[model samples]
Target: MAGRRRSGGWRALLCLPLAGAFSLTALSGCGPVPAPDDPEGRDGRAVQRMLDQRAAAVRERDADAFLATVDRGSAGYLAEQRRVFRQMSAVPLRSWTYRLVRTGGFEPARVGGRSLAAQVELRYRLKGYDTAPVVSAQYLTLARRGGQWYVASDDGVVDGKRGTEQLWDQGTVDVVRGAHSLVLGVGQDRRVLRAVADTADRAVPVLGHVWPQEWAGRVVVEVPASLGRMAALLGASADGYRGIAAVTTGEVGGAGDETPADRVIVNPEAYQVLGDFGRRVVITHETAHVATRTATSASTPLWLSEGFADWVGYRTPGRTPRQIAPSSPTPSPPGTCPPRSRATPTSASAATPTASPAPMNRAGSPAA
Candidate 1:
């Protein structure tokens, strides 16, 4: 879920940092712990109640009620939260909820009143957009004021690590709604966002043709200002993400329920260098991952998953490999590539139509 990083300490549990294209990993970092209290669970219940109200406020779009959950005495934190809520207005949320993970996950040295550091998890979905919820790890410094708990500061550290950067945290969120997409950008031009939406809108139908499953048919894209900002949002060093055009966040394998819509985070710098044909290929390729990966497990071989995506992406006849990667050397043959054991994507070629990609076993190979 992270693109990942240490926030002041409440970072999301993460796996599979991406490379030039994309990668998939399951999320199961934080485990549930018993209630903080021995029997009554009064203190834990109170904190959860306050958090419930906070989640309700966002769902209902009530600023005053939203602010009520925060410590009123903390002027600086209160003001900052005011701005965060206002920015959220542009984005649409279908569901929002908080689950208490564990108490005493961390200790905040300096606080105004009675404080308890807890690890929390936030699950939220964009209305008419997301199929499953996007999960985030939360750290809270809860304050007991007048016998009730108020969120003192969520920016606190958990286990000496901080959380990832959120889309809203960047700046004023500029939302562009395409027929089949929702583009959210910060410190980016409106024209750039619309183009992203248009590209995504076009990709959805193409995905439907090859991907035999139900999907939201739409995607939510996060467009940060620069490559560095993109890396920060992913919580990684710029070096790892430097030339990578984009990355997707979603479950690798799970078909019984509709998988969540992927957040196709774009690297503006790298993406811009890709011309019209190049841009279409990349966006379409990533969207195909969103569609086809519902049945792919973490143990699925890179060849099968990526090769499947490549198969779906470069569907146009006579397309060449150089057009996809640009920097790679051309294959010896003009329109076709050399054969291999499994259908993994090669630098100079895309997967063929008959390449037998199928259900994967934990050993990273096709099942019998």
Candidate 2:
């Protein structure tokens, strides 16, 4: 992965961008075509080789060399590029698919030596997920550098537009342990959700042994489609936080119009980015927040809250970050929150158990 370098002082994973084909554009100044001796299939083969190299770098979470190959310009562009890589690092291989949709702009005398542009479609299959596949049309630019062709840019990449209601209508949740209620829905694919529900159903005194006792009655477990729509509309915020899973509402302690807990929302599109145990791990991480008595607090630190969530989410079995991101001394503000004086916790409130929360769990609700 990202070597040992972490971003600023935070230990949270630094998400990077994945290179899409539709985003890159080849400008004017047409170079002469290759010699007639060039094999007809060579161009595609060359592109494949370049893709393999880039993929290897991605697998390693090497942002520096990855952007270097793409001719990224300006700090903002480079920053966004790195973000794509970080996101890609989390996606499972089986869920991601790249297909060549078109090919042209073949020319010579390009930076790095030769240049070619191709149109490709990237379809991220959502596995065990009820949401629509996040599809992107990519424009890929390639250049030969030091005798080796490299991916230069990806232009016009668009995440698939879909509604969240569609996702929830597709799956079912076996249990809904909330402060208000438990919800029962219908669907198939009853594996993990069922297992978790079964564990809860038996009341076998397992939660404390499996998870922290504090999580008892505090944890809210939802199925894949639980909040699909809310997630889609809020995945990417207007602020710099690209690909935001959800925003936390309110503060850690109830003070100055403060609430007891914060609200958490997620984007279904983000689920498609996960590979391996990504889906379960992310959900668990978010759920851990719900389990906490306090909203995220300064005393907890970014690394502990985020990293510990990740640690617990992956606690299921056989899941870990691909590469540890470089640590940063500076901490990123949580979502669009403004700075304020920290408030002290009055006391731990008793958690109430009830049926499904009507506001949080809207039956057959669509993404707004």
Candidate 3:
């Protein structure tokens, strides 16, 4: 959970990368290796060729070519793979890539002792959805049939664990793209989806005016149907997320020039209860965190960060604390009141002025 540190002006929760037996390396292209006369060497080369074919099929979105890479002998596996392909076809993908991390030594298979297995990392991104590629480690078992190596099992569990499912696997999500924003949501509520899109439309220009132009001014907001789904997306426990309206999550450090895969996740239940004004406040506050994501660090105080966002959100609404607090009696005191104690100007308390506090909820907590 090192990635989950609250160091970047927002609370973060990082999912653990799928672990495997092979040493990790950045994906890169490699030249073809010369064929060896040894049987083991020949088998390894054949497996690598099969893997390259599979990767190419995914990139090209060729269903026939993809299916050809799988072993046809296993009818059950092939059928399930067909279903997965159908699901993937429904979603428009921006890019898909697979890298062969390592090829393990030839091992015995269920059919006979002529099969081999390898581990690989698959990374992909969906159009108008994912900002960065999602990575997963998969175990693949291959077998030689008709003088060709075909994938016998694509998802063999390593260390008794399987990789996390892709976003498309969770459920059907409708994507709406604006000039400067991409909004993704589940379910059939087109009205709610349009409302989110409209809010993002109004927010982008305001954010551009209020924040530095270091970022591209592009934002992606995800509104899951339930808080449970939101928790799953942020890699946090549902119980820990109670009463939270929204959160900004992504990778922290990089070149600090381009925006990373940061996204604003809205708590569905809490957000549904908010009226127009409240919705704007919450969205703008979260967007502020996204705009300043690269600048804010772990050392930034939460109060200052949250306070600035609150100020930006409430500044233009023309609502004052006194107007909100109608029940409180207005006290008319003398212009100059007697000092209670002789506090020095350099003192911490003396340096700070007591101003009217922001409106709070019935539970005495500040509203987002």
Candidate 4:
């Protein structure tokens, strides 16, 4: 049987309206980001400036500038911050920005100076590889020192929530660049990353033939050491992506820098279980997302995006819809199109409309 898809996380978010999924990306486009309700109130604007400086430092690769944003008082976090900065040396970054979502998310105990907690949204794009930024949440606690607010720590707890775990947070990042793909992995062997790159490279050209549009024509694949870490990279619970082969992450209607490019993240266990043919289908399926992202938007509807990708994937290796019908089980559900049969003409009487459309998980394989 073919793999299944999902009805959660990336699939759902990617298709949401511009004001919904891509709302936080206000600063990404030509428009100005909405100022905080009280920009000049209680050091809110100060914190925003600090975040701006931090983003610039990352893009410029200036360690000193990056460290200036940290509060020296938090020794452990400071050291980890340094380590994370150094770890990013090999990964080429095209852009990085921080948007302060809100403040007072958590009230931290004061020690050296006055402190306040805030939730900040972090956005970054890999150079030459990402058109849109991989968006993540950062729970931060800032301290006032010498009348200036500094990032005290990122381990802030608001309703037991902390900053989202990034790939660098897990371990050292290893990069493998292909003609049409860039593979980033944590704690993965070179050969494994190579295989991912090779698979993605093969899929890109094939995808172009079907999806004739002006797209990146490339993909970025992230392979973490385990399934759990894969979930972490996506800031999702493992349950949402578990048992799935792979998932594509991206945004729509992005003519310029307004959205992030498509990413093909593999589920180690599930993806590895697939045979060669299955892997090709999965990779090609996700590559199609990269190719068709800007061509369609939230207005296109979920079924069109998913069903089209699935069709393109299954279409590759020269398989016809007739050949695929047998492997796909159609449960008896009310009001479904009747199956074609030699004994009877196409009629509702013989139709087994037992199931709803495949839950729109937008997965490359069987959903969890």
Name the candidate that leads on lDDT: 4
Clashing residue pairs in all predictions, respectively, total 13, 53, 1, 17
Can you write out model 3's per-residue Cα lDDT over 184-203, one digit (the tens) per residue?
77653878877877887777
Instruction: Looking at model 1, report the run of 10 residues with the lowest lDDT sum.
Output: 359-368
lDDT of 2 by residue, 262-365 (tens): 23333333433444334444444555554443444546676666555555554553322322111212334778655453653221110001121111111111
| Candidate 3 segments whose C-alpha is farther than 4 A from its true place | 1-55, 68-84, 88-92, 100-122, 125-162, 256-260, 298-300, 304-307, 321-368
Over all chains combined, what TM-score does candidate 3 have?
0.60
Q: Candidate 2 has what TM-score?
A: 0.30
Candidate rank order under TM-score = 1, 4, 3, 2
Model 2 poorest 10 in a row by lDDT = 349-358
What TM-score does structure 1 among the candidates reach?
Answer: 0.77
Off by over 4 Å in 4: 1-37, 109-112, 157-162, 318-368
Q: Alpha-carbon error at 218 in model 4, in Å?
A: 1.5
Per-prediction CA RMSD (Å): 14.3, 22.4, 14.0, 14.5
Per-residue error for 317 in candidate 1, Å, reads 5.0
lDDT (10s digit) by residue, model 1, range 1-368: 12122431232232223222222322333322334532225567777888889999999999999999888777777888899899878888889998877677577434686788767888888888887887777787877889888877777675455665678877889999999889999989999999999988888889888887776688788899988888777666777666566777777777633454467888888777766655666677778777766778778888887777666666765765554344433455877776554444554233221223211101111110
